[model samples]
Target chain A: MMSKFITLLPEELHASLQNKYNEGFIYLLDITAVDYSEYPQAKEEAYALVYIIRHKSFQEHILIKTYLHTLEIETVTDIFKGANWLEREVYDQYGITFLHHPNLRRILNHHQFVGHPLRKSYPITKGQLSYEVDDLIDEMNNRLLSKNVVCRLESGSFSECNKDLMFLNLGPSHPASHGTIRTYVALDGETVEAAVSEIGYLHRGFEKSCENHSYNQIVPYTDRLNYCSAISNNIAYVKTVEEMLGITLPLRAQAIRVMLLELSRIEDHVVCLAAVLVDMGGLTNYWYMYNPREDIYELLSKLTGARLTNSYMRVGGMTNDLYEGFEEDLKDVIKKVQYGVEETLSLIKHNRIFHDRTQNVGVINAQDALNASMTGPNLRASGVPFDMRKDTPYYGYENYTFDVIVGSVGDVYDRVMVRFGEIQESIKIIEQVMQNLPEGEVNIKDAAITLPHKEAVYNTIEGVMNHFKLTYEGVKVPAGEYYSSLEATNGELGFFIVSDGSGIPYKVKVKAPSFTAMSAYPDIIEGSQLADAILTLGSLNIIAGEMDR
Target chain B: MEINTQTLPLETAITTRLDDAIGWARESSLWPMIFGTACCAIEFMSAAASKYDISRFGAEVVRFSPRQADLLIVAGTITYKQAPILKQIYDQMSEPKWVISMGACACSGGFYDNYSTMQGIDEIIPVDLYVGGCPPRPEALLDALLSLQKDLRTHTYNPDRHKDFKGLLDDV
Candidate 1:
């Protein structure tokens, strides 16, 4: 039954929250934001007006939205500890400072990071710093700046900390940080006191760049966001545009998209699983996992032409039909994948060393996970059966019968098991798609949105002109706002597009799963030993591409 | 004494026998450090798997700690942020070590040209052999192994040419 309640609170408490918490109570889903660029007053008001959502059922959602003006926006941090990073992120990206935020240094960018990168007015070409190795040599030779030019960059009373607490900068160089993300971890002896993730080291202002490029051009940039699973990103972005345009993909096209997505998921998970094993010092598992992944890539290359950055999905449909020998090759690869998975499980999953390293490490409880807005395997490991595919039933996943795997103890070992179970489920999905392969047009005949056939483009005059125009000047969508979220190999990969009925998106905000998952580190690592932090990080599998983006 | 030099085929035979024994020792036990930096690093892992089975060549153990390794497979894109660390790891490895630069990015920074990437790993460290392709297939990496094995047969440590690329010769 649906329950509704209306209560009048004391004006003083309501006013304080409205000013401090932006809107005090988050009612609906976990969290959401509304762009106020249209209102001139929004720029000065210091509040972006956020909605906190609590989901009850499929279509039932409750929203709690309030407006708080400044850093006077006091920390709800006490109520939701996970908000520590999210508030910091909202501040870092939008320049919306939250009051009582303990440490609000730039999370995404470097210390020398010039400006707030996510502001709508931020220029794409201007204010970007370029560094080349050759340039470094030239600078050294010029003598305008000495090798050890001791500029007093920071001269302030910043030394107010416990003698027991030591600050450790873990990355922007370390192998395990994967990309350019650095963590400023404050440690009390061997246990972590507090840790903050620093991002924007690889920030290229992609969102701003999207405004300049056409919808088609934006696909290539999105590929670099989560380079490990480029296909999933491609699918998410296209799906958002499709929702806005109000177009339905053909049956064959849907199957093809699912096929490619599952393959990408397999490859992405294999690499991450391999990384964890490699970090734990059992190097052989890394070897066994990647062989089948390579075979999958071979299929990808044959089907999409490029392996990693395959911009295969078009707006209305896919770029091309499936290649002739794809099914036969896919069947062969599946056999190899089965063999590889078995070998990996036997070699490492049950091994004593593997268990000792991963078990009881980086534990997160169910309530804490929900409060933090955790999704994907990280949340699923904590006993939340919230798979986007199963929970929301997207992309024909409802047709296939698969279990939503969960672990009792939300630790590193559980995350591994959840992923392992998902891989088996993914294999089953691919097998079903192959068994029930349909016969029809792989791409739609929406000439306005999709490019013409190659034969028509080469042979006919109108087709030639249409092809050129579509390639350079992409088709525009009707003015509307749409959000699409998919269960990526990592987590909930979402795209929120704001269109102005132009070829370019007015504002495109990507809610990357890694960025959210990494935000919860401070909460997860609160009482754990320092060495356990690395183990916990590997379990989360936060790809810097997505996190920094 | 000059007339006697024309008569001995036995002396040449013994020299050839000694050379084969030395080559066998050099070919076996190539310990490669796990220097995987990107996607090609994934393929390097595959080369060590059961199906590809790199154990036949006696090079299966991908040492995590660099001090014990003799071969450095420079896999994936070598970014500017990553270059110095790569150099330090290369320096830490024992003497008589060789570098097999794997993939197009490691050979020459694949597609990223604007900034952030180093263009080529050879610009930073001396590469023994360069494997080409966006990310060369695992089988292609196996080919790199055979080529690195050939390099071990002829090249030896020389202090004079340590920093001098001008004096180096193509073994092929």
Candidate 2:
């Protein structure tokens, strides 16, 4: 289906959104701002707001575009609560203000940071004066005090009540928090009365960097996002570029890509499950799962050079063909992973303490979860069966037979169960791919896009010239914009690229799943105890690299 | 109750140096702070796991609190927003602390040479060891730990060492 872009005036945004909401576009996927100041065409406005909305029932998606002549624009947070962080992120990067946004503050950068980084004029390597802990703490205290959002506790004694009600800073360094998310949790006794999560500690300016790097150079950077499943990020990014280039993969390449993606899914699930179990005091479970994780890493290392940051995918294909004995090694490792999954299930699935800690904890209902634009196992755990692989088939995923695991109660337990079930399904998919592994060259034969084989480059002069040109000039993508997404282990990892017919992308908006999922933290952990909050956060599997990026 | 070394037989003396004994004791038990920031943290976890067990090196205890930790494995990227927290954690740790800048990001910002990432964590905190890799393998981290242990065993601590040492603030 073609995407219809409706350019509305700032005043007409609300009504347009209301109309779209009535037309089955109920879910707002992403909100990003693009600066078209330097472009030759599209000179009508300096900054354009791009919104990606999806229909759950009809499975139809559309891109809503509106130019902002002024810095201010109407907010859609009233219509979609998930727009809270997305709009803040847009404001933070582009200096575009949302008029009616409740907490219209910086989401991915320090409040003291000056100038919008995503603007075409902003330098990529410019560093700001770092804030001291005292400065940040004072700033937080001021914000809390001005908002008057602190809650009071009612104990027998006034002094006891006052002491019981206090703000506790959870992270930016705390181990329980998977990444560098600093949350200001106002606690009444042990219960979290209110929590406001502050991100951007690990923000490396990914979008800004994408503007500087060429199409191929950005592949390595994509590995840094959701490093747990670097291959998935690599594939998702390369797939987006390929879509813009109108390149199709060979059957062998497609099969290899499916295997790698499934392998990454298993690795990500194992880490998520093991981390959650460890946070809940199940240290043995962490050991049980890490063994298989290491094996998977070894398998990945055998295929690609690196283990964690496997920049394995190229523009039109992969970096290398599957190594000899890869299938045998994969079969052996899959068996070990299956055993590890079973062992973990037997250990924690029926354990009394595991249920006590996870069950009924961080219960986010289906409507709230969808409102937050939650994806991956987190969304499925909330009883919404939305898997991008099943919904939008890619890489010949429609040929595979697997179940989309769903949970009735979206609690910590449900999240863990869904991950466990997905891991099993991934193993099954990998097995199926191995049974029907295709035969052909991994990289496409396009001299302009794909790299020539090393043997050809060494032997032939023409091959040498092509390789030099491809490396130096990079793949020239046609001038266009495309939104490509894949069912990443976390959720829907989307890459929206606006190409100017040049090597470098004009705008690269990464709709990180962890970023959206972590936005729901405050709502999920509001009335939960501190211990339960930690467990729930662990269950969410918020990776700071992707969240901040 | 003790006999003089000169007067006692050569076989019975068995004398040992004080510095050697102290270094051995200190190097034998290096409690690392569990301060992992990004991808390298995963490799760090794998190093702590069963396969590539770090307990054998006497660096197994991954303490969450900065006060109790002696070694800071600065894994992953340290952004401008996180640089202060890293310094605060390093300052909170008691004296005789060591740091291992794991991964390319912590070593020299890796590929993220943008506004948010710090060029290297060494700019904020003094790193004793630097491990190179995008996210260095578990084996690389273990090697860094062993080398740090070797330095602790061999090098003598001098009060004047701090005088020649310069930090990122000097450039700032």
Candidate 3:
């Protein structure tokens, strides 16, 4: 079996993971904990610590299940640096303590937050009385003021150097950080001595909401995660649920999904690269990029009703077929995007200022990036040619011809360039898919899985009864757990679902790419200038929606 | 080329109160803070972009600093952790400011009525207008701004006026 459950003493975790690390499970994909207190079948353990790891060379992945009957479990941060925030997140949600974890505190919810909301026992509507706004600000300011760092002078005398290191809060509502991400940087003049990012400013408790919502009802919520590429998020989520149900999509549906995924990829990259340039004082490029993005949105609006939140994907297939004239509209959008990409390249490719601002700044070495469990373009830029699309070809990604773009000396410039290349590759993929469009039904005809047609529902008794059951109770997925991932616009967008043979998912854990990418921000910006820090953050493309959720 | 304004009667002149002039000036150039938290932020950007062109309504100058802005367009979902930060930003903005809660999330938490999201931004700060959509379209956001402009023109600066305007605060 690819996955195995091993019960080990709390102290044996470090040694066991060390053995696994040597065995080529070098990359840690995710570390999450699930509470099984309410489940009568799980009498041996109250919480399950789930660890997903991947081999560096073979691309083989394994799920390591370790059940914890006690509150405390060994911290894997020593073995994998990326486990720092992952452990904290698991702790924050499941209230399971990770022993010896560095800075093990709340990662998503506030430090003042009450009961772990991910626990089944926690009330969904239970609200906490947060500190007064003014008081919170005052307290934060006081804490910043009180933070003292001693620096040794040239004469070898230690002196209080807090005055030299100015602590600047760069977000929560800043133009440069894009969304509601706050990076507290201790600046030595313009150079950053240290940096720490505080997220959860956009945490809507998506997991908790998922537990309460039915299978299909959770589609809209998926749109909000990685809103730039809503279709990709939608497809990633539904694909996971579909996998658990062991459903196979039609060839046409798969082709359409690939098309949309590439389109979403182009959209995400355009926004990210444009926003990066804008942060570096290239306002003209924002217009150049967004103009095409607006056209894509128009096409998307025609395909689905909404422009931004296109919840287009269903469990078995898609919610609706491509609208009439969709091909022509899509062609027009592709042309526009191509024009925009060319124009953007001309404007910034040779610009000396752009190079000076981005090149060699916020460099994350390949080893550090791997240790941080970075994925997608960010990891690829660090000289790691690990694209999930290439590694584990899903949704017939193997049928498509594309290059896995990689860059050496990972920096802001390399990251931006990687995205630029990915955009071009996505356009190529989209054009290829359009040229060889498949013909068949978009959704599966299985009455038990997909909803019945309206005509059949109105005319036939069995159809009416089937539609009612599907609509009211939703699809009853067999009791099983599955982790499905896709090459999301940002990176490996994964959804880990635990089903209990019910219409509602027992546990829904979103392994958001931006979440992991954002965790490495402090490390990336440690020694860079304040302006370059902004540029690096922009290139990271850490969407607060995806990160916090 | 100077006209004989001294010869005209006081009533014949373009007579207006200082408050009316202030209201007109404030209404014309309402600088909104760029405070977008989620998907609605994208639509908000589109409104400010070349297509919808929010500059036509004199709200073109999108200020990143709260101290400089006069309007707070809360453009997406505001969570519990962000509520205090939003309140702080609102407090920082100069007085006689207006807020346009753009999108269903900011208006009433939209589909995410969970432990993290605030039920509505109005629970923390007073809102002058609420644009409705999971993420309202750019045109809806523009309409909200126009309506906010109308409110700014007619409404008095007195703090007590907000109490009478409570009916407008109903869920969109």
- C-alpha lDDT of residue A88 in model 3: 90
lDDT (0 to 1) per candidate: 0.68, 0.86, 0.84
TM-score of chain A of each: 0.84, 0.95, 0.94
Which candidate wins on lDDT?
2
Best by DockQ: 2
Candidates sorted on DockQ, descending: 2, 3, 1
lDDT of 1 at A492: 74
Q: What is the lDDT of residue A106 in candidate 2?
A: 81
Residue-level lDDT tens digits of model 1 in B123-156: 7678878898766777788888987776555554
- Candidate 2 per-residue lDDT, tens place, B1-172, comes to 1346778777774556888777888888999997888988998999999999999999998898999999898888888878878888987998788888999999998888888889998777777789998888889999999988888789774434444566554454
Model 2 per-residue lDDT tens digits across residues A213-232: 88999999999999999999
Candidate 3 on A150-192: residue-level lDDT in tens?
4556896645455576667888788987888888777778987
Assess the local accuracy of residue B130 in candidate 2 as a C-alpha lDDT between 0 and 100. 92
Once fitted onto the true fold, the runs of candidate 3 whose alpha carbons sit more than 4 angstroms away are: A1-9, A132-163, B1-13, B17-19, B163-172
